[model samples]
Target chain A: MSEAGVSTLEIRDLRVAVEGKEILSGVDLTVPKGEVHALMGPNGAGKTSLGYAVMGHPKYQVTGGDIIWAGQSVLGKPPEERSRLGLFLSLQYPTAIPGVTTTNFLRAALKGQGKELPAREFLKLIRSEVAALKMDQSFMSRYINDNFSGGEKKRMEIVQMAILKPEMAILDETDSGLDVDALRTVADGVNRVRGDGMGILIITHYQRILDYITPDRVHVMAAGRIIASGGSEVVAQIEESGYDPMLRQAGIEAEAAASAAV
Target chain B: MSELISLRPMTRDDAPLAELPGGDPDFLHKLRTAAAAAYRESPWPSSSRDEDWRRTPQIDKLDPASFAAPGSSATELPEYLARVLEGPLAAIGASHTVVTDQAGNVPTAGGSPRGLAVPLEEGLRQDPERWSALLGTIAHPGLRKFVALNTARLTGGALVRVKRGQTAESPVRLVHGVDQRSAAFPRTAVLVEEGASLTLVEEWVSPEGDDSLLAPVVEVQLERGAHLTHVVHQRCGSRTVVQSTVRVKLARDAHYDLRWALLGGAWQKTYFDVEMLGEGSESRASGLCIGRSQQHFDVQTLQDHIAGGAISDLLYRVAVAERSRSIFAGLIRVEEGAQKTNAYVQNRNLLLSPQAKADSNPTLEILANDVRCTHGSTAGRIDDDQLFYCESRGVNREQARRLVVEGFFADVVDAFPQGAVREAARSWVLEALDELALSGALAAGYGSA
Candidate 1:
């Protein structure tokens, strides 16, 4: 509603397509600095597509609308440029890069951001962060997510998020494979790194993670459009009754919209 | 041995076959004479006809006679060669170091008991019986045209022998350097006696921009219960052409390990032949080659299991950029009675550019039903998902590609034996990547940042 602020990630009438198939029809959302927003949707609701589009993935083409960050449309910008502009996307399925150590990759990422630190200092930072995540010290020397457990891979993503310390973070399914203990650790890691100046966008389908990371605002999407946005009460509403009640309230056919989203 | 021989330019017609060095023993002269006859009899390999030479073109254009033999071995060491001797090779702390260049065979540093390390001519002169018995046994001139040429023109060669039941604490290095318009032939003979173990590094290098030819041959014989580690490093100038071969034979219970690093030269072809001749013998071979520009690198390997209960494993990797090309061909053969033999060969190639080309062919022949033999070959470009993963972490596309390329070599380089050698190779690989970037090949081939 308000003009996009300098420190906010504003998606206005955003339309995205993948392989000529339109996924996100008209998604509008805004996450200003110092706020945590949760995007809840059923399977194939275009939530992951929105996260990738915001990160400037080459495959997720923007058909219309704009993704304005810092008061500038980030259209046509390459993924690396957007990353350097303080945007982070925690992939749902992070690919393994063999022969690349976690420390070396993280150091390169930091150097790319012009935050190069001395060798000893960088190791110290990595050691402390890895320890904070309750990961083994040997994890720093192992290849990036190579042969890592499911929980370890999820923690590795959070580690990158913490080390890069981006201005805005979009976590896609960070709680999907995590157990109770791992979910708590990951939630604590997020809370620790989510400073006042950093904006957070958590994309999840369930209400369990919401209990750990209470969101300032919650939005629900169906058929590529955000149907509802309000305080945390929206979460309770969805928890009490399934999306059918919400679809009924919104005058949209639940099955048709759900399958179309698929 | 310290007195350098005055180098004289000789064409193919005047190759000194008639006037074999008078001071040499009868066996030495006979070997040379026989090799000379073989050189004249065999013709250069043709890519169209020889399956092993199919990937290598312009074989007829290489005139070994056009380039003069390495000049007076008295020439001062170049800055680069001197730095190498003082750096990684020096850090290896060799038991004996021999530098063969225009300056001749210079014993730069180190020593071994009972004259374990000496010039090839001196070694043959000292114990003609032992030298003659080992020479031509593995890398005989009749094997190939280039081998014959190397044997006929062999100069500035070195011999490293570890006596029986002795274990050398450090390695022996035979470093060879060539000048522009000059050819170098360095022959190395390694003999590890029964119960003895040693490490040998044979290196060939030249200054940048030198259009030269370097043909080297190495023969290794490991006696029963002996162990040996061999490294053949070739980093010649970009304009130089290289043809090299290493032949190794293991006796009963003997072990042989080889690491061949091919990082330079404009056009290069190399061969590795390993024979496990006795029960309980084992051989392992691994190498890496990084090519840029229009350079062509072809490597062939043979693993022959002659005795039952022997094992041989080979792994070779190549990364090519620009219009460069690389080919890896490997074969594993098990004899009829070699029932318990186990052999494996794998070749992996990374194409860093659309124009860059790589070919891998790994074949196996098993005559023994009880033998286990497997071969695999792979050639591919960097995965798009991998690239995107790095890019999303704030690394630019170019840097991301570089990281992926470096990671591609990390496993191979880490497998190098000595710590110094491994570190040196890691730095050189990084340096090669930097050179590729500076030449605009990375930007031109890989997408721009």
Candidate 2:
């Protein structure tokens, strides 16, 4: 009942709401094999809400939609179940679990996915990843996301994504509140994880991230629906002109269609 | 088996227990008479609608008719204890001293002080002047019926004294062996003089197939500027019942640290009462309890701040598996005019099975305006998200659960004093975990020690 592709993720007519308020309305998106799609939307445009709904966050209710992943329906699965289905969402605000170290947390997640790396090999991978992210090795010993700086927290999210290596990855505002160097390092990590088997959905309000990790297709979202779809040039246009012009154009088209129907 | 059946019922007529070297019959009589009077005047603690004893209903099952005075000598310790003492505790110059009855005996190591391991009857006979002021003062005044019973019927115990300005480099270990199928009451009293330091460990063990009752009372006194570390390990047999009470008194500028590890017992109840009676005193009390099967463990603690400028901190961790249950109740009281008193109490429990149960109550009573006091209690299971996170990394479900449980208790384990005690405790904990894993109660892939 869904489009066929080598890609594992298919979001069709996805409508999401939070507490009886529609945040994402009739949003149709597709992330095919070996491609990265950047979702650009201003504040309160339902960017993060979409990411949460796609990843099966309990709070984000999908009133009307279906998420088909890898030829299977994943709409009713829990977060952990979705994770096992090769879907991952890097949270904008990671939760701090005291008494649980990052190393242990990742090891559990990996084990849940039916993969067990030896302790030494696991440590080696973590060390290399930490080095690539320009993070200290001691961070692995600390509690997960406990008392971490903003940039360090972002790097931790990327590190988790790299280690988990899900088939479809959604980064929720990963570039927000990061300095230039930090942002660049995060983008590099994301780039390293990108490949033919992986499809990334980078959600952000700013276009600065596009400069580091260019997307094959840029989708502009306004008031919950995808208003425009274009190449990388659209990101520059939105950065220069903001959402007002495109929002006005969308409104004009809606009125014209309504008059013709009457 | 014949010896166990042929054993005569212990009574007051059984010749008075032996005295320590330089043995006073008069002082012994006086102590016995006073304790007997206290027992007669105090009523036993009953579970008939009383608030404190309601949750622990087995307290009322103790029939006074079944209790007999402790006999002289009767049971053998398990081989595992010998192996443990030789392997870890021995490395720190510590040796085990087992007391079968009132016959007070120390190991051949010859490092222990002459009067350190004296029995209660011996303390009364040999050193009445030094023991009289300490005998009943530190313990509560017939706080519970069993405590009164212990004072009334005690035959033997360990009397440890640390001289002024002296520090024992190694721990002094005492094993209180409760034998026979009847009630046995044992007592222990310790005295640490000014500027002296000592570490004392007491273990209560019951041999296999012995369905016995043990009521124990222990008192500790810390002189001005003295430091004392006390650890109590209670691991009775599954069919055994035990009731224990420990009271500690700290003088000005003295420091006291107490750790209680409850591992086994069919039904066990313990009370820890620490009284900071002098200014500038500090006390730390920590405990860990693990219960499985139908075992029940209850711990009640009180941190009474009677003097100004004294501080106390308490932390208790409990884990329950199978159908076992654990209860922890802690109260910190800062008396009026005890200004600048700082006290905190935290109790955390982990439920490993659906049938397992845990109840934690942490209370603070502050009568002073300028004091700082806080108490918190938390009961939860392993975090599902954390478990999934670990499992996703290739750690199986069981191993993931084990890691999470270990992490839960790591905060308390890290607080243990360094060296042999800490190592021994860690090894024992790992052994318990391994047993669970092997029994398939825990998941596979979690390696054992």
Candidate 3:
């Protein structure tokens, strides 16, 4: 965190590798508090790796460059500690924890961020958030996404993001595999929680979610680094064309080794 | 019992005249004498030689003489034993405990209306005939060396008998614990008469202390149409080696449900032998064992279908972390004339650390036609993907693992018939996980944010 404790994530030429193959190569991006940016990219553009890399997933190595949070380098910080620093990652696929209820997990997650609420108050807040996301109350007691359907898992991820209320949340394909109804509900929940000193980076290949919770800025990722950056207009352009224009314009140098998957 | 009273450190010669523990019964005394002779001639069980002990923790030595028992008094009892029994899981309303004072010759705890729970010595004194018929009748000695040892040297014992047509609303809890560094043998005999039903929880524990050996034996008899819900929880000290035997018999239309939860102990050997002797009888057994550090666990189970149309299902789960190890070998034996018998056995082991090891063998022996029998087993470690998912939520890596491990055991905990027992198991598993985290055994699981 910065000396003044301001919320700002500055990624300067960050290079990340997973199992000897680099995913994010010399990438630069900046997310100031209270701003939502869209990271538009295709399936193999290393978008999820960037999100995990930002969250400090151990499997992802920051072989080069630096990820500055506020003013401190958070390259070596563990996920939970970095979470306490107000960073969050909403995974594309939220896993099932057989015996751990969503309510208990959310409570523990919030506590890790140093936010302890009375039981009654916490219950009230969770209930309100669950209702706001159009989720059934029973989901609170069910195992963490154990048997949740595709759409339900996406909504659950958003619900967690709402409860944790981190300063910055990296949404990794929260829009994929979601129906129109689910997309609307997830976008509604994200919009409700965002714009309150919380910065968000929504990673997706399509402009479907952009049609709901509009992003202030859009960046196209090709190969490993950002090839194009612009305002919301980039979203319309990407929708009109696709990653093909960006992928074609930015030729692959192949500086990093390839042919491996994490 | 005279020869066993105040016997110094156990010795090979003490095998002879190792009669009934509570008191001298001519019938049991004769059987004990024969077991003594058998113990001398029985081959020393080895993991390499005996299939039942194949995966059992290697015992470099057996020194019954090196064991010690606590002095006879509540004052002399260790505080940890008291905390373990009375603290987390307070004694239930219908609870039983043998007072160690006066050589544990007294049944200090109360019992239920339909049941009579008393110390074996006190029971024998009050009704020798009844005690004689109930004790040492089902779990015969000399079947195994440890069983023979327990049958021969048991110092403290208790018996519970549920009358006919009685259904108990609350569990009859029993606390078997010790606070010394001696080989303590606890023997229990339970009889559920025809049409009687009750929930029984037997907890055996030994807190932090010097190296010790504890060998407990239990025999349960379920009469025709009887229903018994039995749960066993064992948590021994790190230096202790525990060898326990459980034998159960189910009569016509009887229902037996058994659940076990185990933790700790340097080396643990537990065997549950169940026999369905009557038609239409049914039994379900489930167990959960969590081992940390360099602890080793060897659990062997057997389901014998002696009569036709009986059903038996058994499942055991083990979670080992650090350099701990777990071994499971279970068999479902359908004897001749046991046609149409249905039996299923399964074992699942979770290895939390790379060094942690597990071996499982769920076998079936069908000697009759038209019988349905099957066995399945799986051994694995925590999914790194799941670990990463939990860590992204702000739970520290260790905390994340703690959640996943507890989740792994949640199914069994939730399956308990009683809400109180379910809650207790859940919290106890979490407490054990927290303790592991404190000891830094789960340090390797700390997930990078």
Candidate 1 on A133-247: residue-level lDDT in tens? 8999999999998999888998999989888889899999999999999999999999987754689999998988999999999999888889899999999999989788777
Across B1-449, the per-residue lDDT of candidate 2 in tens digits comes to: 21232244433322122223233245544554555556656555566767677678887766644645444443343353444345555555553243433223323334333545554555555677787788777774456666666665565677777889998777777766565465656778889999999888777766556577777889999999999988777767787788889999999999999887788778888889889999999998888887778889888899999998999999998888778888888999999899999899999998877777898888988888899899999887776555544543345567766777777776666566678777766665666677667765565221210
Clashing pairs in 3: A78-B449, A79-B448, A79-B449, B67-B182, B67-B183, B68-B181, B68-B182, B68-B183, B397-B447
| Residue-by-residue lDDT tens digits, candidate 3, B153-224 | 665667777889988776777666655566666778888999999888877777786777778888999999
Give the DockQ (2 decimals) of all models. 0.68, 0.23, 0.59
Ranking by lDDT: 1, 3, 2
Against the reference, the lDDT scores of all candidates come to 0.82, 0.74, 0.78
lDDT of 1 at A23: 86
Which numbered prediction scores highest in lDDT against the true structure?
1
TM-scores for the candidates? 0.93, 0.81, 0.91
Model 3 per-residue lDDT at B106: 27
Docking class of 1: medium
* Runs off by more than 4 Å, candidate 1: A1-4, A245-262, B1-23, B69-71, B78-80, B102-114, B444-449
Q: Name the candidate, 1 or 2, with the larger DockQ value.
A: 1
Interface RMSD of each: 1.4, 5.1, 1.5
Candidate 1, B60: how far from true, in Å? 3.0
